[model samples]
Target: MHPQYKADKPIDCPICSMKLVKFEPTPNGENKPMDSMPGMDGSSSSTSSQASNNTIYVDPQRQQLIGVQFAKAITKPLSKELRVVGKVSFDETKITHIHTKVTGYLENVFVDYVGKPVKKGDPLFTIYSPDLVATEQEYLLALRSNKELSKSSFEEVSFGSSSLLEATRKRLKLWDISDKEIEELEIEGKAKRELTFYSPVDGIVTERAAFGHGKFVNPEMDLYSIVDLSTVWIIGEVYEYEMSFVKLGQTVEIEMPYSDKKSLYIGKITYIYPVMDAKTRTAKIRIECKNPQYTFKPEMFVSMKIKINLGTHLVVPEDAVMDTGEEQYVFVD
Candidate 1:
């Protein structure tokens, strides 16, 4: 090409001085950089016009077009919350099994149904026992003998009828026959055919095996399984790897599956099971919680979160983060 042709079209490779050809591999319709080259003046005509039109004047002394990127150096704190799922349970220690001390037929069950709440000394059932009747008769005879012997001519009662009467009264007491029952027997001068059994603990009856309206019960058979609802047990199922964060005393936030509302409860790691579930790879941790309102029910599912402070470390917004697996990165503006 002659100098006149080059000056008019200016479509020649600067290095090799060849005719310019466009490349179509890019989104830009034309790629004319194949032949374009900077002149001896160290300037480009196309970019110069854009710089003058969109330049930002930072100070009166200088002006420059604002670029779309910036960078910041920061240190982020790594605070993590570990989430686990667990179930609510009754505190094993607070559970009581009301059993019969003496075998007898359950003539009447006043509180036979399950889920009945009872307090200490509350009548639970009535038992008709031949043995109790005979004992009561002996107590009555001892009482009458004491009154008769006191009037004896002998200054000192040889057998000590007063002592015998006291011992007899104690026998009934040992059988958990309430003082009221014993007093009634004392006043009425008759044996109570049916003894009313009272609850030994304040709790709800979770299990009961009253043999119908009229059934026999043995000392070995559990008459009723009572559980105190005032306090409950929370079993936290934590991953084996995350078990280190769980200690003897840790504050936990419990959220019920039914609703998003959370309950804050302080728990002590009273028990950590020695073994982990082979398939689930989770360890069982028992926590004691007070259910003052009895709102927490047994077998209820709950989500637990254990907060862990990893100390102050670096962090970045999720949107600004780019994870390459081997390295984490953030785009500098």
Candidate 2:
């Protein structure tokens, strides 16, 4: 292993201290280390023309001949960005389901078409329920009886009539009858033929089951589905190994697949599904976002980015050891 002479025949490798072996010249023909043990030394440190603890210490001349480059490993902050495909969906909490409290035929529908925007207390439809009419007549009769018993000397008669009136009013309310309608009925002294149900919230009707002048509906039927689009949910899937980086309240950036390319939606992680998909081996994460003007559509595809910051860690350049598979390192010179 002397620098003054070259080994033309079989000789022992000084560095490996093994049996006889012949050295093949490097690409540059500069004398390389007799033997190199990958991952034995840190990326950078002082070196001499000696191998210690299986660390290959190359001299400056040999280092130049082999075009050796050294980089000092340093501690620095790093971050990883996860790019994934996401799907836009309605926030379940913001979705409102319309159902009738009583069975009846739809006499008239104000919100006749899907995608119609409606506010709280807006008329949805009118129903002609014979039972509702009978209930209304009972309420009127109770009202009259209570008024008659108002001056009765017997407190028991007065209390009995007042209780009947209250019970009738409560039944009407339970049937989705508004207080305004009850007041109007009291003044008119007659039950209206049609009972109208109002929109329970400010939202856009996404689905409708009632139509025409005679659509029979009951409590079990889903008359309409209205969704408040001000807030939406974006569900994204990440690899099983990457699930550790996902956490609640982490900010995420969203880009629509078919909309304006320049526009980006900001959102935050609201939930992380505990189960992983068996087929794709990915975990689902839900992000909540504000959708102004109904910018997000249900079932639409989107791209999402989530950046995870990793604390300061000792790192080096990207390089691989030839024989060593996982463990990689560099020589010190």
Candidate 3:
């Protein structure tokens, strides 16, 4: 067998079953250097080849000519990085679902479309709730009675009237009536037939359940969903084997493959979903990112890399190992 090629001890060709033969080099300087096969070292013309039981000796010239390289095995901090596909999602903690406390017919709708930007106090819709109007009327009647009885000779009578007025005022407030509206009611001495609802926060309306004018609605009906995209969530998945490296509050690098900037965004893992996908066998992790300029949109796909330190360990070049099916080996020199 040649020093560089693997062969069975019986010295027979596996394919043709031909008996193998061995040959030695000719007299020195008698022949040009033989061509070398790819992956195998180039033939050395400087000196004849020499081999022992399991190792071959190649001179420095031939080793350098074939681009043979060496790397020192060392102990160093190591980290494993996994690139994964992630999708943008709404930060559930920052989402507000608009629901009415009163049952009534929608009188007017201001925020009628999804994707509309709204401020914290922007009016969302108005409802003509007979119940709301009735409560306001009761407040006005109590207000008038309290004034008329304040000068009463009996302290009990005056106190009772004041108590009734305060109770009615509290009821309206409980129904989500703004203090400004209550003051307007006091000045006007009348109840508003249509009670307007306003947005609770500055956000974009990702969902709107506009029931239309004159359509009856109740507390069970979801009127709108305002999402504050200034802070968003990214949902990513990692293989089960990589789950050990992930942790809550771990920082991750996020990149949008479709974006022109190719900029990297930073985020922290806020949640690790308990559900493991049966098909993909991956666990979902939620990362919270500040969406400056509303950069991330729901359902937008992005790429992310999760890096986890593995402490100190010895390492070698990837090219060092050569696998032979059942076993693996490497050339020492």
Candidate 4:
């Protein structure tokens, strides 16, 4: 038996009835000293433990295995890009409402359908009003009276007939009659039962109240609403905290939803609504964009991005910062 493994008393194997040799257990044919392990009382190990508490040390192999990366902090110009959802809408300034100046019945609708584009002076509908016909007849009668009285030797009779004719022509003009129509009436020497109404501006018909022909229309009724799509507005809601960054004339990028196109629409911030939405805590901003192609339609969902220069800032990797529920912190190397 080895002297290092010798026991204080002799022990015999039960089966062999002979003295048995005792030995210490060895793992992998070696025994290690406990003090040589980590967290031991040795000075070197103690220092390493203390340093590890303040610093993280990862070997190249471990770092590669964990996919760790590093970045440097530097001073540079920075800009914050705020993203928000917006809606496309019509430019109200270019909208025109078509209304009848006199009570009438819609005799015929030339530009009959909603969304149909019309130009200035294009015939929209013809209206039949008894009062309008009466006015036309009165003007014709006054013109004939003037012609007959012009031969009267008395100058007063000639002047009075000229005044009556002038008054009658002015009344027809007040009723929205175009000068061309009145001139044609004088040449033809007749009054038509219906007068055709023309569009006042170039635009698309957005709303139409005159559906069926011969429907009674009053001066108060809106017969048609036309909006010019050459210019449009994109209205976006921005958070109150981000309102300070918004400014008039700032250019923004707009992206349409569910579109396969990669190019974004560019718009300029034209107006910022003074009031904020109480429930949403956001303010409204209007961005005006040109729609010469007539691609943007009203009520379309869109996304907008506005970039604001924040000047110089200390920049770091986004992953370097840690955000706690109540606060934010970062680890320094």
Candidate 5:
């Protein structure tokens, strides 16, 4: 019979003359399971009397069986997923260039510096144009004629001066002059020598091509580059080899360098440049964003995450999944 080992003392196995492994006793007076410690072997003890009689050696099989059982009950399951990198860019459609409809000197500058925000119909600059002055004169003459004919018969108002009034108003409107300006001119009965040019859109003045006071500007030279900062693009440059994972309308997360925060932007592969850049060895992809608060600026560096969906596939934690570079592995427990 095997000798029973006491919980508080190190007992020696009489048969092998070796020290037996000690363990804490459970509430039922049995030893608590220790995976590292050896257990009772069936060959050494077939009955309870034999187990406590003389001495019996611990068995390796029992330790392994307990270990297997513990692992099976507590281990977690994990799956593998794919990860990729990308970049941020601007939406080309949202971009526009601010230019002049008439050729003249940049007499005055209202939007004085670059990066100045201007709203639609907000006067950007005032230019003294001889042609604009001539148009104003014609409009004034037509207004005066219509007023004079209004005292007469409806026939004169409709036929005698209608065609002339319509013709003059069309010329002023063609030059983007608002009807309000025309009404103000008619009431004041004065010709405005300088024409005010308003911003065509809501945007920031990106480039001030407008030369200083008295600088000559023509249609050939751009006056100012107004950019709407509300929306921007995230450019994802995919290599020819990595093209499969990047499809149109894939959702990606962008990481900004300045903050720990990240933004989720869904990208529809709007434009894929047909030709590859010979120098970069990459294809150009255009991403559009609606940056209302102007958080994103031009040329701001951004990290992109392109997740490839395997469709109903399993996914694992990035830390738990061990990447051997060539392969991936995960621990069961």
Candidate 6:
């Protein structure tokens, strides 16, 4: 038997029937009780002795070494700010594609370059189509015939000439001939070899397929793609679990990549895509922001922040929580 097991009053060890020793507290204030020793069967006696609700005791030196911290549980309003990355894009609703309605040879290129700003009715290009010229000549012939037949004594001849004139006018209009151009043609009493086409929207040209003068273009070809940048969209995705916190009209803060703290742009959530992405498990969202100064450009990456007010609730430091496989718990001081 170990000399440390010697005692004034011999007490038998429950495990080995040997003389037991009384326990003494160590300098660090930890006590090794005899009952905590292993039994004769080599089973931990403390396992059966310790209660499930027992407190876990740690010495001050060990606590200091482990860097344990304490925090008070308090009720306070908690707001969660969700940060996400987004990409700047042009507003789809404001995008316009200009396509020719008739086959023609691109005669003149006015708005020649991409990114050129243009307004509605601004001349974009001129096209020369043989069919369009023929239609114009037919309209002129009908106009001259109507004038000559107006004095006819036969009412049938007058009505027939009037019908032919109206039919020719409708055909020219169907061919995208503007009323102003038609009136000008009527005044000049001649056909223009080339007709100028104007932009239908105010925007910057984003794409131009027409190259050089006299390129043969058909109605199926997209001549120009214009995108109005007055209002732009910030597209982002959020975890599907956080979908409830997002709502239409919610204000979002957009920050440019590598921008300063004061360079945040404000926008409103316009849409939340209903479908969730299978791979990312996220839902897409759209935010609309005014870009009158053209500060935001398409394809630029930005950061978005949204604050969700969760109201007052109990809170604790994140480090305080511990997961023990089956359950989560926290230690309180």
Off by over 4 Å in 2: 1-33, 36-50, 59-62, 320-323
The residue pairs in collision within model 4 are none
Give me the displacement of residue 70 in model 3, in angstroms: 4.3
- Residue-level lDDT tens digits of model 6 in 86-116: 9999999999999887888988899989999
lDDT score, candidate 2, position 250: 93
Worst 10 residues of 6 by lDDT: 36-45
True-vs-predicted CA distance for residue 275, candidate 5, Å:
3.6
Task: List ranges where model 3 is wrong by over 4 Å.
Answer: 1-70, 322-333
User: Mind giving the per-residue lDDT tens digits that candidate 2 earns over 1-333?
Assistant: 334444577665475443333444544454454445443433432332344665554554454455566778879999999998999999999999999988889999899899999999999999999899999999999999999997899999999999999999999999878788899999999989998898999999999998989888899999999999999999899999888888899999899767756688899999999888999999999999999888788998999999899989987776622335876555444
Per-residue alpha-carbon lDDT of candidate 1 for residues 180-233, written as tens digits (9 for 90 to 100)? 888899999988889888888899999988756568887899888999999888
TM-score of 6: 0.74
- State model 6's lDDT: 0.84
Candidate 6 residue runs with Cα over 4 Å from true position:
1-73, 150-155, 316-333
TM-score of each: 0.69, 0.83, 0.77, 0.74, 0.64, 0.74
- Badly placed stretches (over 4 Å) of model 4 are 1-73, 150-155, 314-333
lDDT against the true structure, each candidate? 0.74, 0.83, 0.83, 0.84, 0.66, 0.84
Looking at model 4, report the run of 10 residues with the lowest lDDT sum: 25-34
Sorted on lDDT, best first, the list reads: 6, 4, 2, 3, 1, 5
Residue by residue across 1-333, what tens digits does model 4's lDDT show?
223334456575455454544344433333322343335443233334445444444433334345667888999999999998998999999999989889989988888789999999899999999999999999999999999998899999999999999999989999999899999999999898999999999999999998778799999999999999999998999999999999999999988768888668899999999999999999999999998988889998888899999999898988888787887766566
Residue 57 lDDT in candidate 2: 42
Please give the distance, in angstroms, between residue 73's alpha carbon in candidate 1 and its true position after superposition: 5.3
Clashes of each: 6, 0, 0, 0, 12, 0
